[model samples]
Target: MFSKIDLKSDRFVVVFINDILIYSLDEYEHAEHLRIMLQTLRDNKCEFWLREVGFLGHIVLTNGIQVDPSKIFAVVN
Candidate 1:
């Protein structure tokens, strides 16, 4: 559904699946560009947590980093 877009300017993209960061790239940045990229992932049955989307290299959590015991264990194993 999505194809790589070659642009004449510098842009960056970071895509994640199910709260786990997966892809990073430098390319075009536009609504359609993001849409197509997301649609392509959906078409391939990739899952995402819409509420968890955030900046690259950072994890999304309530009240900042999750330090609870249960949540920590669940994430680690």
Candidate 2:
């Protein structure tokens, strides 16, 4: 059901299972993208959540993405 909609490029969007993450270089672009993505989803009658994006063992930060400390402990413990 989700494979039909075209978002132009994969650089701005990431999809995993039921989660979708839309990102941009600045707040303005992000907002515009949110509007477009939300409208697209709405037009498709799809439900979505506006939550902080998570990448399992990876940490997401303002400066960059990092590996979760717990993941390293779990790996080497």
For each of the candidates, the C-alpha root-mean-square deviation to the true structure, in angstroms, is 8.1, 4.1
The sequence of per-residue lDDT tens digits that candidate 1 reaches over residues 1-77 is: 22232231134344333432333222333444456556445545644433343544444453354344544576788
Q: Where in model 1 is the C-alpha error above 4 Å?
A: 1-12, 15-31, 38-42, 53-71, 74-77
Question: Residue by residue across 1-77, what tens digits does model 2's lDDT show?
Answer: 35733444465877767656677888888878777777567546443343443576676666778787877996778
What overall lDDT goes with each candidate model? 0.41, 0.64
Best by lDDT: 2
Return the lDDT, model 1, position 51: 37
Look at candidate 2 and give me any clashing residue pairs: none
Please identify model 2 stretches exceeding 4 Å from their true place: 4-11, 42-52
Candidate 1 at 36: error in angstroms? 3.8
| lDDT for residue 5 in candidate 1, whole number 0-100 | 26
